[model samples]
Target: MTTTLHVAIDSKTKKAVVFPLVFSGVILLLMMIFGVVMLLGQGKLIELNPNMFYKIMTIHGTGMIGVSALAGSCIIWYFLKQYVPLNTAVFRLNVYLFLVGVAMVLVGIFAYDFAGAWTFLYPLPAQSGGMWGKTGAALYLGGMLVIGTGFLILLLEAARAIIKQYGSLATSLGWPQILGKEKGFGPPPTVVASTMVCIVDIIALITGAALLSMSLINVFVPSFTIDPLLAKNLTYAFGHVFANSIIYMGVIVVYELLPRYTGRPWKSNKIFLIAWNMSTLFTLIVYPHHLLMDFVMPKWMIVMGQVLSYMNGLPVLVVTAFGALMIVYRSGIKWDVASSFLYLSMFGWVIGVVPAIIDATIVINHVMHNTKWVPGHFHIYMGLGACAMILGFMYYLTRLEGGRIDNKLDYLTLWLYILAFLGLTGSFLFSGKSSAPRRWAEHLPEWIPADMVAAFFGTFVTITFLLFLVRFISYSSNIGSKINQSDDIRPSTHG
Candidate 1:
């Protein structure tokens, strides 16, 4: 007797998958350019109107986060195609909801001239002008809600696929079932569906519901009072976890790509899997660290936040760094630009995680909570780590699409981009130590010589990034015919 396994692929799903990845790369490149411009102006390295800075910031936040969400959903959608055939109806629903949702967000942000940052904190919205602002906010929320419902449907489909493949969700949940009853019959460890994506999606949906509730309350019952503390907690909870979800997606890329490069069989190492799972578990409860500066939050909660923050770093550091290290050390690693970026991404994570861990300390939080140090820590993590990984993946995918390795010019451009980011973000951190404030149009007396030095670095960094932007545009336009067509364009699987 023979058993057949089926996988689905079609033009619509293919387009849905590829469009978001390419769109995100283009958007991120632009965001970095804008960020460099903004920093240059603020540091007095360049002269620009104050309004431009806010506008760039608004665009940067919205564009980057929008891409992050699209990328996350795209990954889920793509992977689901491998196991279960997504119904045409569901696929159409997914695309429509996502596009509409993104449109609403853009309209809302533009409506308010949304300079208040993506955080969209309360009282600021109330202070903004006109019905357009309110409509924009509603549209943004509506879009997300619709996209979220689509995710719910996707999750159910994934769950069904898992059950069909492995008997039930319970069996799929643990190691034994994944290991299988017979040799060569069991799914690979990574092949078994993990709950991380679903869990994160659920949390996002819950947070979105709360945000919607807050928006409705503000609109209809203008006199309705909200506890500032509660509002702050919910907002940070959503923001923090939502940001981390992108990092988790990066983790997914690492898992999928690393072993291929090493030429080793992808092992279902239980410890590595556990570490990934642990990181997710700890991350959900750690958002309160953002609120550590609040005096009103309970002392126990504060302590718990700090503890969770510290603990969370361990699993990420171990699983990502150590896992990559082990793979690289033992394998005949190749040194293409894509792999080079992947290695550098690990360093970026290390740099950001250390400072973030430090900031989680109560003593350190007292000093750095509202300072430039905050951006310093996150820029390395989000801007460099997450964004770098995305770029690496983009290079790999672009190579696949174009049927060749990216040209030498593209490689040179990528290195230049990396150098500029490090210089710009590193200077931002140094300025923070000397008490330079973030998001300010002008510096006060407290700004010292260190700030001046940082400004100089910022100027050079901006120039480097500007050059990078030009190069990227050139590369995108001329992704020529396949150069080396036979090589596996997907990430290496040496393990």
Candidate 2:
């Protein structure tokens, strides 16, 4: 727990993280509102036209994933800087690019009525019927490309710095430890995790950018076309990898903070190194599971997808969850908002993986993959798992820098957030079990009950997040105040 950092984070670098967190919190609440609105429309409680509903859906999916990733990057930057000599300018650039991309996406959706879902699956952008045109598709796809470029650059920098400091990426991932050459503790868990994320996300983002660029060009030049099957492959490969990577980045918070609160060391041993390496491989290859419904996707890929999907996140999840329990078992660790949320995040990951695995089965994928089941598993996974890490880090920061103490309302909101999220995800899973179709703007009378139930709970989830956001914003000023009034990134620093 007393692991001292070689590089000290100046006040300015701290703000780079603090600002992104607050922004992410604000976006979380906003996106949740859009979620509830979609549910209300499906439940027939609100008069949402199909166009408006789809627009909201596109933004909701895109915004939640984007904001969560932004928040996750904050966790990575905050702790990772302690180990590596990072150029804060690159980090700051990511946030800037995210904001600009978000603005363009907003205009594309609301102004131009871009109704293509976040999947942006190839030909769909070029063929939006009369709902949207080339301009809207360009804006949305271009926005995504811009965001992906920034993240890719940030990751490239991380990969470079890791190589510079540790001699190689393999060394940083503790290959020596995993191969039984070095028998002691490996690099810090943060380094190992960051290295894995860098490798996977860099590949994921580049693949996505290629697809996005082709999609954008196809929009302007209708004669240019891509094979739909190939497009779907690119879609899930990029979407699944990029989206899942948020949790990988978010988990850095868990690894860093758990041991700190428990007053124990979270060592990276051979088992831990092996688990991470396994996770990286599986995470990259498991996207094929998402395409099991496509019969044309070759037999071997289908078999491999189903097999790896079951193993995808299990390795690191098991180690982290078990390590957490062992470290805190009877350590008399003090309970607070941060600690509570950290533990809750683990519960989220564990519970979320079960249904995800269930859906990954070849048979179940045929039945449930296109239904609300997919959303049910991922919501809990992202909501309680990844988002909790960001929220925990928020509380963790408040306590560390602002000396913020919990009020009764904090506990009340925590209970409301967890229970409400459970209620919402439960309704989603139930809807899937009943064969309710997902991504539909309107629901049949039979599905309305579940839709309404989800809407009811979704409202609370959004409201509780609003409270959480407000709380974090209240202390944004004191979050490690080494303020350099100039937050600008100088071009010279780019080199």
Candidate 3:
């Protein structure tokens, strides 16, 4: 006699979360291609209208960050559902709001020639120097506010679910067990990470909302005044925290997914709790590091920023990566695309930190702060680190109902993307060493070759990504058939 065990699957809900993730991923791919084109234009490898070049650059910066956050949040949302009940209606609403926001942003950028960078950095959007009008700036700010509203609702819901189940935010953060050592059972690592990230993100969103609102008001009434320094601090504080939280949100997948591949539980322990708790505190203060170059900034605050930057990097990443290494060591795990990306992302996270730490040093920042190195380091960590994790999760999702991976194509795509990404980033780093500035529309003759090399390799990154994206979509479509098949695998265990 043979018996089969079938686990119930929620295909609709899965698709609900997945639709937004994949939609954002598609936009992300387009932005990468556009970014490569912008590089080519800058390098004089191809002729591009300077206005279009800056427009593409502006949209690319803003879109990539937005998509990365959207994808990461969806991944976190999917996993959080297993432990706590979530409102699918609210999730769907968030998706709709995100799409509307994206549309408005594109209109502002492409249709109206808004060239303010992602930071917008106050005054720059309004002072677009005739490149874009005040209406365009208002549209951009309004779009961000809408996006923030969606995120705020989703985050509040997640907090409500976690707190309802875990009894309190402290318990969700695993503080009761960590502080008192009276652990019976606590929320898992994913929950802890999600809880921590959501708390910080909610606060960041509030600050961002205030900034955008004030900017909108100032655009209409020039009489309204905002202190530049205060605005700068608030801007960096919100932007840095929002960006950093995206990485932590992606790491939640690491805590949840890596263990399954390695056949390890990745239990919520005291060390894990402590590391995340430290993260909650450190993340808020680390934004000051971005303001280190502002001369008017208080000296003590600058010093505090430097200290928090070092402290933040050491705890969460170091602990998570070390545990991941230990879990995989001699585990005889079968290598798959999902697992491979997950493991490699850990390396990217650590390696990217080296340049970041160097830049954070006040001495080095004086020379390197405004150079190509800024984008180089951030792209490595974000493009390779956080983005890699989300891509891995995408692979995981496509395979959830037992879809097969195209091993050869997976290997080819992964290697091609990595090699090209490394070369592109290396060019930026080397150019930064030579004091080449960032955000320039055109490069000098000496700088053109480096930009050309970057553009050349960036083209490969875009191609491989497109290939990966097509394969992911293909596998995702047949999940229902695979799930039904999974229900039929029978086994004989007893006499």
| Per-residue accuracy of model 1 over 85-179 as CA lDDT, tens digit each | 55646655665676776676666666545465666666444445542355655665565566666656665566566667767644444445234
Ranking of predictions according to TM-score:
2, 3, 1
> What lDDT does the true structure give each of the candidates?
0.62, 0.88, 0.82
lDDT (tens digit, per residue) of candidate 3 on 1-495: 322222133666677766786797799899998989988987998899888888888888888988899888887787788788888888888889999998999998888888888888887777777989987888888898888889889999999999899898898988788877685545788899899988899999999999999988888887887987888888988889888888898987788776666556677788878888998988988898888889899998999898778887568898899999987776656667777788888988987888998999999999998999988998889878998898888877665553654478888898888888888888889888888888888778888889999999999999998987887777766653545243222212222
lDDT of 2 by residue, 222-297 (tens): 8988888988988888899999999999899888877766667799988999999999999999999978988989
Give the winner by TM-score: 1 or 2: 2
Instruction: State which candidate, 2 or 3, has the greater TM-score.
Output: 2
Which pairs of residues collide in model 2? Answer: 11-482
Candidate RMSDs in Å, in order, are: 5.0, 5.9, 3.2
